[model samples]
Target: MPFTVYEHGAVAGWDVARPLRPGRSAGISLAGFRYRSAGSADLPVIPHPAVTVVVEFGDGSLVMGDASGWQQRGSLVAGLVPGAVRVRGENVTCVEVHVSPVVAHAVLGICPAELDRTVVALDDLWGRDAARLREQLGDAPSWEDRFTLTDALFSHRRGTGPPADPEVVRAWDRIIVSRGSVRVEDLAAEVGWSRRRLWSRFRSQVGLPPKRATTLVRFRHAAHRLTAGDSTARVAAECGYADQSHLHRETLAFTGVTPAALAADPGLAVDDIAWASTAPTETA
Candidate 1:
């Protein structure tokens, strides 16, 4: 697939590129980014509902640090809801992949729960294969080629890796379709599984239990809406929050910032362009 490059002056000096076509799997999405000038950047890593994989190339360096002062550099993977982490780098260039937790287990070759909401070196997970991938991406002639290579790698992994349970996938899809408003009991009934069984399987396979997953999904939606300049009160009501205070509490808990600050965050400002069609939409 070809890439559509944009000079994104609005978002922290990033030159972004997204695939003309979506990845082969609905569970995976990719975007490429390059810094226009050689300089350092420290941007907050906002929590999202997917596992994030970043493959860094070029002469620049990429480092991810958490609130606890734990840090990892170079190509890395951050699990779902990686809390209070920041990405720092100089002239960074990389292909960022967001793998839906439903299929992250198969594509990443490990249970998402094992990631434990922390950033880790990709080499720690993929071993030497991670280094080879960075080399391949760097050697690629264009952003389009880089995206193609990434899609191929994930396609192969998902094909050969063990699959998440069918019931788990269904439940996750329903939560997404409902924009995280679906209750655990409803999901269990729809999937024909006991509540306890669903909770255990979901936590083990998707990394977060059903309730936590719902919170993440809902928070993700609310964050994007806030980023789009929605009013806190309206967003709260439309997104299933009890009130503006409820929205404020969840936003603060997830991002460590109030709704207004989160709305102005640079990390989320680029989502409309980079994620475009893949971001979930409200279901009727």
Candidate 2:
């Protein structure tokens, strides 16, 4: 088989497509999704290191919330949301932004800690600003126009906040560069902070403690590998689990599904459509 730029996978619905263009910054990217039909149940949402903002337009609305039946309508801003949430709507058109935790505080104007692995209405965060955004996006002529408007707003808002701690940003970069395989102790040492200092700073600034961050980063890598069709043992070994059982437990804990089940998830099967970085949206 020929090797392609197959990095990982994401989501899409009927007539959905990738963003008009990729975000210029290393910390962000945008995807536009549309669905012609409505789902009866909430679709499962998986978490990664990046915080997400979903802006919806069109005929119907959807809720982004957890399994206990908690959900919120209007645009969603979430940080490291764990477990499954349902996304059900009809004739949906939306642009979803993936914000690196490293810069999320600046872009979103709140600590990821405040979000605490939960979904909230974007309006709650930006108040009237959120309403303005919804209006602008809905009125925009095209997906590209909406995306540009979004980027401009984000750029303007992001510049208003103080930059995230430099050391914290470096630590996050290291984790991604290492594919989540780096040691936290080593990271702390490199950042010239004691373990306790690193823990406090990272948890407050990035929303996850150093240890948990590593686990989530590692789990993210493992989840992608599973979705990419690697065997349990291979993914476990390559992603640094002690054994397949260790991988099993962690994957189950994160996704609420066995590795096999997660690999075959229809929700994620379409994820590549939403997140395939190099590909443009495919129309049908």
Candidate 3:
């Protein structure tokens, strides 16, 4: 697997796909680089961000959007925020872009309110500006230009820098090492802090509470296993769930689909799980 830098910025470095597995994606970050779906391969939707960039190619290509609770299909290349969807095959090849919260903060320096949520498409906010952006950025544009475009599109939503709380980082690190099972109290003690302090900082930097963040990370791990054809019972046990049902309930809550449904569809089940140094988002 050859890794290439797709883009770079003060916040991160985006690298191109180096096939983590047969149908999985490994780490590839150069902050704020946009990704279009590959036209040759059809992909299944997994638990993912509300806003993402997708493209299609070949016949029988379908993309499903799990907006809120509704799942629908179409050429949903523009709007993908914090939702899950299934992408049907039409010989479509898809590539997903990863955005940094810090870069988003840089873009929206003063208006912290805009940072409250996620943006699905550049055109959604810019309208005609989206076309102009595509036109300026041909098949492959300079990394600097890509970062600039991303920054400009998200500029109005930036806020204060991520929290300076060491406890938050410590807790996040614990979850990563534990594969998402460290107790909040245990983490607090390790950092010599209280649970309340840990929560405050975790929420500030990651925009989700420690418990929820832990759950999300755990779900992502399970999704990876399920997509890779691991049985629900096995995944549940490995992820610290009480049982398969426990894992099923949590997966459905975040993904709106059962483990069986996900595993049944190879594209969605075995797609890439984007694990980042900061935040992780699962993509197909």
Candidate 4:
């Protein structure tokens, strides 16, 4: 697979290394990135449905926190952060994996809802194994090798953990296919479960409750469109928002930026080159 490199905006040296193909795991994908700058730089941690994992090997430290301040972290395994979080660092190199919430339980060994609105260090979750993997990745000769190793690691662990209920998986697929346009009641009806039952099961297994998850999915679709240079009116109308103001409020809630501002963001400008879809490898 070939790597498509991209710039990191105003940062002195910002580059993204996209994988040639997707990972073998369901709803999992990887992207390798390297950034260096004399001055510190920040990247927005916009709200999204996927739980993000970032394993870094670089001289500069990465901080994950809000507008107040940040705390040091080795490797980031982040779940549904409600507000804006920025990752600030210099001279960073990492392989980032995005795991859809549907498979997050099996892949990350916990419901994303448990870790929602927070970032946790990999060492805390995976223990010493996390450190060993970091060392191995740092020693790897190329980005492809690092990605392969990382993919293999996640695949190995995924098999050991319990899988989400099949019905919940189906429901999640439905939500994605509709781009969050489907109603939770309709999802429950399709799965042969009552609305309350689906809510309890989905909240326990996938992460957020049905309604919250739906909103996030809808907003994320709009965020991508905005990042892709789509007009606010179009994104709003197309993404299921009632009106432009509806889009504006939700955008601020998820990204803390207005539609036009979020659209103009430079970090998101490189998504086409770096971001892989949450869809799995075999099907995709």
- Most accurate candidate by lDDT: 1
TM-score per candidate, chains pooled: 0.92, 0.88, 0.59, 0.90
Error of 3 at 80 (Å): 11
Superposition error at 246 for model 4 (Å) = 0.5
Model 3 spans with C-alpha error above 4 angstroms: 1-45, 48-64, 67-81, 84-95, 100-119, 123-133, 141-166, 273-284
lDDT of all predictions: 0.82, 0.75, 0.48, 0.78
Instruction: State how far residue 90 of model 4 sits from its true place (Å).
Output: 0.7
TM-score of 4: 0.90
Superposed model 4: Cα runs more than 4 Å off: 1-13, 70-72, 276-284
Better of 1 and 3 by TM-score: 1
What tens digits encode model 3's per-residue C-alpha lDDT throughout 1-284? 12134322111111223222221111113223223344433334454322244422223344454455554442233221244444444433224444332232233232122433332433444456555545543433343444344334444333333433556556766776776787878888899888898777666655566687667667877877786778899999988899998998887776567889877754442344233333332233
Cα lDDT of model 1 by residue, 162-207, tens digit: 7889999999999888889999999999999999999999998899
Superposition TM-score, candidate 1 onto the true structure = 0.92
Q: lDDT-based ranking, best first?
A: 1, 4, 2, 3
The numbered model that scores best in TM-score is 1
Off by over 4 Å in 2: 1-12, 24-26, 38-42, 279-284
Clashes of 4: 0
